[model samples]
Every structure is written in structure tokens, then in C-alpha cells.
Target chain A: MVVMSATTLGTLELAALLTVARLGNDAYGLAVRRDLTERTGRDYSVGAVYTTLQRLEDKGFVTSRASDPLPVRGGRSRRHFTLTGAGAHALREAERHTASIWGGIGTSIRPEPA
Target chain B: MLHVTPRMRDCIGAGARARVTAPRTESPPLPERVLLRLGVDPDFTDAVLGDLAEEYALRALRDGAGTARWWYSREVIRSAPHFLRSSFRYACRYERVRLAAFLGALVLTALAVLITLSARDGPPARLAGASDTVIVNSREPVQLPVQVLDAAGHVLHITGVRYQWVSGAPLHMSAAGRVACEQRGDALVRASFGALRESFLLRCRPIRRFVDWRGGLWLAVGDSAQELPIRAVGVDGTPETMLAGSAIVRDSDIASLRGLRVHPKAPGATLVDVWVGGIVDVIPITVSKRVSTSDALRPFEFFASPLRLSSGQTRRWHIPVGSYFVSFRSDTAASATAAALTLSTVGATCSRFGDAYNYFCLAAKDAALVISAPGGTSGAREFSGYLAVRRN
Candidate 1:
């Protein structure tokens, strides 16, 4: 059977995928939220970060595995997220799509891409 | 190969929520309890709550504990809806078939109970504020049919039963079981509640119809017998209990009548005459091959409620189809002598004897067993009697 590709990503989904990619081996809910907060200057809730990661994982753009729990009081196992090959390809397509959409832009208020 | 850790045995947050010594983090009791109460997936609980606590400690160090708690509460509120949805959706996807099966069973059980009660499929019912008799005098709608029992001999208390007419009558019966007078005729109706049956005579006016004797011609050859169940009905096919009895039949080489049953010795055709309350009828019988069923005798039970008889009053009962010796007796000697109670049946051999109670044993060669109490010189008129039947 022919496969249907994952749909285009929303801003939050795109940002979450990139954060998981950038974090590499260390990516999880808290790390992703901190990274997104630093880059976007918006302190997103961990719930939103986890939710987006879950959605990306659902779309096969990311995968996740639970780690051994931290040996501390009230510490629980962490769910580490990883960017998949589909995620990388989707990111490249999104960049291409955006570049194509902005290619003809020339305005006094906003300059066109170089 | 990867080594399995001790933690790996547990699927996160399952079983117990017991806390152990760990690095100080923000898993405050109230918010954690609230988040847990939101019914998040247990597999996700350890990771989700762990991440929240870790972030809580870090934030509490940078900001104050109060601010961190405020932020923690906000995060819990934000996460609750998503976790709930995901958890529910996960449960639905995984347990879809089982859930469907369970719900189907529940629905079927409820439907069965509903159907049973609506159909009134149980013991007789007592209509609220309704009499034992159903008279269709007016054009009115009813809920269900009523079963009526006669108030003679002994009163029968019944409810939630339906009227079944033995023959057609000049009476209009509604779906709700209300009876209306269609014409000036009487029909006997019977209602059976499994083993217990109650029959009543329906009267519209003066005209009384003859009770129907429901049976077919039967003849059994050599050592074979056939049960002739007599159903007494009214003029238009309703039940008539007054004329329910049988008469004697000749014990011949061809066929013999044993109570209401006929046993044939030889083949060929024969006519058997029966009488009930001065009414005589002859039915033809044809005995072919012997049937498979046996006519072996078994234990029997026969009883009647204590009968109270007035002067010159007579009552009779039909011998049920079987080989049995029936006995009738007055309750006491003084009452029997004063009442002059007599046990007699036409065409059936009977012997009278007994001083303690005016008692007599009647052979069940006949159908109708008549008991009469006549006023005597001793001046006592009314008396009670006990009737019993035993297998012969």
C-alpha cells in the first residue's frame, strides 16, 4: 500500500522537533522546554512541550524511550525523545516551502530574502 | 545485550505511590495528588511528574519557593486536559473490543429484565383496586387482560392473570382484558397460572350456555390406552366449570373406560357413552396399533378445601384422568348424621361405610363424583366434608 506522509508542522511542532534534534542524546521534556524558552524568549509550559513532542512522535517525526529513574527523592524515569529521519526531511521541506513562498517578496516595510 | 535495571520491572507509577529518599524537588502533596487524580496514563506518570519536580527544584532555587509553587500549580493545570485526553484515547484504543463487549452484556441484561416485567411473565397479579370479576359494561381502554376466578366452593385470590375463554361468547373482550356485554349469554372463562388454574363463569344476563366437552375420538388396541382430557366450555367456546365430569363406560373385550381415560383390549371400532350432570353423549373410538406410551400407575394427590354444604345442596367434581379410588366423608359423626351427607356417582361402583365420619369410597369408573347434603330429622342442616383421592 502507498504511504501517506505526515502533515505540515505547526510553529510549536517545528520548534519542538528542532529542539529535540539539537539536544541530541539529552533531549526530553524539561530540556526541550528550556531550549525553546531560551531561543524563542517565551517560557513555554512543560506540558505544552511534552504535548508537542507527543504529537511529533505520533506523526513519526520523533521517537521516544524511557530512561532509568534518577536515584533521588520523588525522582522518576525520564522519557528521552529523538528526531527521526522523517523529521529531518520534513524540516528541509518546510524551509524550502517557506523560501519559495517568500521568494517574490519585495516591500518597503520588509526586505526580500537575499 | 542490555542489562535490565531494577526500575525496569515496574511500568512507571503503577501499584504504589510510596516515596523514598531522593534529591529534594518540588512534588508537593496537593498538586501532585491533583495531577494524579486527573487520571494520566501510568506509563507517563513517572516521567511527567519527575520532569515537573526537577523543573520545580531548579526554579525554586532561582526564584522563590512560593513562585515555584505557583508555577507548578499552573503547569499542573495546563497539563491536566492533555493528559486526560491522551489517557482516555489510549484506553479506548487498546480496550476497544473488550469495552464494547462489556457494554453489550450490560444492555442485554437490562433489556431482559424490562421485557419480563412488561410481559408480566410470573405468578398471578392483583389488580390495584380491581375486583375479581371483569365486566365490560362501558367503552373504556385498559392496560392488560384480567384473569377471573370463581367465588364458589372456595375463594381464589389471583392477580395479574389473563382470561382465556373456552368457547365463543356474546361478550366483547378488550385488549386490556376488560369484558363488555355483547349479548345476553354466559361464557365460562379459565385462567391458568402454570400448575394452578382458576376458572370462572361469566354471566351477562339470563341465558346460560352448555359447557363444551373438548376431546377427540380415541381408541387404543390391546394393552394400549389413551388419555381423554375433557375441557368444559360455554356456548361460545368459553370455560364452564359447572358441568365438568364424566360417566361410566363398559369394560368390554374391545375397550374399557378407566375414569376419563380409555384403554382398548382389541382393535376395531367402538362407541363409548359418557354422562355429566344428566347430559349423555356418545363418542366413537377406533383402536389401531398399540401406542409406545405406557399406562403404568404412579402415586397421586387429590384434595379439596373443606366443603360447607347447605341443606339440599349438591356439588360434584370430575375424576381426573387416572386410575384412582376417591373417598368422600363428612368431617364429624354428629354433623354427618344431621346433614345426611351422601356420596353418590352414577354408573360408578361405590361402597358406603364408616361411623366416625359419613365416609364412602367410589370407584373411578365414572367421571362426575357427586356429593349431596340433605336436611335430616336431627335438625342440623349445614356440614363440612373432606374429599380425598388415592391411586388404585
Candidate 2:
């Protein structure tokens, strides 16, 4: 198997990619937004979500296809995103990098007395 | 459970009644015009508006309508700038190239027009005609020479003089100062010399000759023929053929006498005898020879005769180059009462032949008409009609 280069992703890119991967086939614009909001407990704007999705697409971390228009969405196609292998690799690399940075920090700091 | 008194129950009943009678206070839908004016991509606009509407309805049911409305307004205001930016970028992406091409074409057109206008502003020369109006024959070209003169009538030796026909006649000037006339009418020719112009009126008269019903018949049979082989036609104007070995006329004359024979005794007196299909007809033929130089001024007219055809038969008529209107009428009562006869031409084919009479407009030198029964039947169908040339 050929190994692909791992791309560096921002916080929003990684979050969106993770949300897409977790949601699987149901990962769309509004669905991803709701998932992100529920997980982070932060009110994410529609523009911020879509703009981040577009940026991730430009970076080739994710790919999107428009679904057929649904009656509930007023006949507008849904932009559904899927995580690529490169995106999964990048996510693994980011996790590994974060774990390495925090490997000894737990021992160096002590919790406050209860 | 807590025990309730009658007064408490009455107050509770009154509160429930008030709640039941209260009007709904849900927030109204967002204005579609406002969403459209946001200049968002159509897909995004639709999806976003739909998402907002769906969520708004849910929130109105769960939370209060007032809170849902505030949430919707905040979301729309926050997302407006992003949609506007994306829409602007998308529009500029393709429109920049189109705008550049349009500007380039406009500049090229302006340069071409300027060059043309500058080239037309050269020397000034006028055309002096021999007469204001000239008469010519339609059959032959007429020579009308014009001298290229300066502003003071001094002759100028110009090699390239452009000539154009304005109206009334279709005539063009060749290199040797000759006017070619195709049709007979009044026409105006204009000669231009670098912006100076002269107009002349020309009247073209049509030449008179015998109509060549058969190709090369006029040459084969000289203009002064005593007898000619004119095909014998029946009273219904259909060509009649005799049965073989039938001794209706003399054996020697039967072969020579194919059509109606004509004999002119003098300049204005003649006789014609037609015998065909066991029927005889004597028609008088008159020839008048009036010689005049002004004969070209007279209007020309064509002679049209009625022709008859049977089922699955075709007939071709030779005519001059002009417009003609042909009308077909069924002759047989059986065919006419049962179904309409179909008539078709070489150029224009009729869509349907349900009507009794069919009309066609022909604009050719030669036209052929074919008659047939319904469904390509070879029944005994007959039709007689006349075609006349339109004079314009």
C-alpha cells in the first residue's frame, strides 16, 4: 500500500472532519452543525460551519457531493461530506501529536486540595 | 393528591377556558424577498432558509415564539456577510472573463466603423446621365452611359465607378457601361462617385413571343408554320389516344395528324380543326401583326387553359418565371361524394386532402401536378382545374 502524506488541519477542520466521520452517511451541513453544537455545547453559526467545510474541501481533507433536493429543505440539495483516508490519517497524526505533548504534563502538575 | 374546594375548582376552570380561547402567538415566517436580496447562491439560500424555517417551527413549539424569532434573526444577520461574499466571488469568477471579451469586441467594432467612415470621405465626383429616364427591353440589355464629371461638369477619367439599383427594377451595370434587365418594370439606378450620386429611372418592357409549350418547339416548327402537331385534347382537356387498328380516320392521315391542325389563310384569318376521342371541334385561329416601335410600353398577359386528369395521372405545364395560383376541383360525382381527391405538386405537398377544392401557390418556371385517390387507390377519379399567372 502506498502511504500518503499527512496534512496539518486546524481545530475547526479536525472537529468538522471528526463530526463527519462519526456521523458517517448522515453527515451534511445542518447535521454536522448540530453534532458539533451538541458535542462542544457551543452555538456554532451556520456560516462558520459551511465556511470551515469549504476550507476543508479545498485542503482535500474531505469530499462533498450534493444530494437530491428534499421537500423539507425547500427543494435545495444537501451538501454531504465524507472523510477521506488522508483525512483519517491526518486525524490520527493530530491525536498522536497532542498525546505526545501532554504525555508528562499530568505528572508535572498536581490537583488542588479538595 | 391535594384536596380542592369548589371555589378553587371554578378558578381553575376559568383559567383553562382563558387558555383555550387565547390566540396563537407563533412567529411569522421570514420574508422570502429578504432572503433573495441577500445575494446568496440559490442552493445555499434555499437550504439555509429551509433549515431556518424547520428549526424555527420546532423552537416555537418547544421554547416561546419570541425567543425563536430572536434566534432566527441573529443567525441570519451573522450568516449574511458570508453568503454575500461567496455569491460575489462566484459571480466575479466567470463574469470577469466575459466582461473582458465583450470590451475587446466593442473596441474592435468601433475601430472598424471608424476606418470605414474615414475611407468613404475621399474624392467627390458626380455622374451625368444622357437623359433622366431611359426605356429598355426586358429580353436584351440596354446601354446607358454616364460621364463622371467634377463639380463643374468637367469630364473626369475615373476607372472604378460603383453602380447600384435602388428600387423598381432588378438591373445591374457591367464593366462596359451596360444595364442588364431581367424583369419588366420601372427601376431606379444610382451611380456613386466617392459620395456624389446620380439617380436615373429605367422602364423595362417584356418581349412578345409564342409560348413554348413544348421545349424547342418554336425552333423546330418555324414562326410561319402551316400545320403543327398540337396534341388533341378532349372536351375535359385531357389528352386522348386512339385505340390501335381502329379505322376511324384515314390510315395515312392518322399517323401524321396527332394533334389539332391549324391553317392560316391570310395575315389575320386562320382555321383550326380538332378531332380526338371520336369527337370533332373546329376552332378559328386569328393572327394579328401590328408593327410599332412603342410596343414595349404595352402590358403583357399570359393565356391559361383548363387541364383535366384521371386517377394516378400527372401533368406538367411550362410557364414563365412568375407566381401562379392553381385550384383543383373534382369532376366525378362518385369520387367527389365519397371522398375528396388529393392533389400534390413537385415542391409543395398538401398535409391533407379532405376538402373538395385545394389551392397551391407556385413560383417556378415549370410546375407539375399529380392527382390521386384516397389511400393511393387506382379508382376512376377525375379532376379539372385552371392555373393563372399572378400579375404584380
- For model 1, how does the per-residue alpha-carbon lDDT over B351-387 read when each residue is reduced to its tens digit? 5433443233444444566778876665557767776
CA lDDT, candidate 1, residue A10: 94
lDDT of 1: 0.59
The Cα local distance difference test for each model comes to: 0.59, 0.53
Question: Could you estimate the TM-score for every candidate?
Answer: 0.36, 0.33
lDDT, residue A68, candidate 1: 80
In order, the TM-score of chain B in each prediction is 0.21, 0.21
What proportion of the true contacts does each candidate reproduce?
A: 0.48, 0.26
Lowest-sum lDDT 10-residue window in model 1 chain B: B291-300
| Candidate whose lDDT is highest | 1
Question: Which candidate achieves the best DockQ against the true structure?
Answer: 1
Tens-digit lDDT track for model 1 on A9-42? 8999988888898999999888898899999999
Per residue, candidate 2 scores C-alpha lDDT tens digits across B1-392 of 12221212211211121001111334334543454353424445555655665566667778978888888778877777666654554334343344346558979999999997666433445678767776553345555666687565666666656667788756666645577555456788877667677888876543322222321111111134434433433223344232111112132211223333332222332233443222333433333222222112111232334556565566544333443334455544655365544556654333322344534344343444455544446657666655332211
Task: Report the lDDT tens digits of candidate 2 across residue range A24-107.
Answer: 999888889899998889888886787777667666678777788555444446778888777788789889877876677765
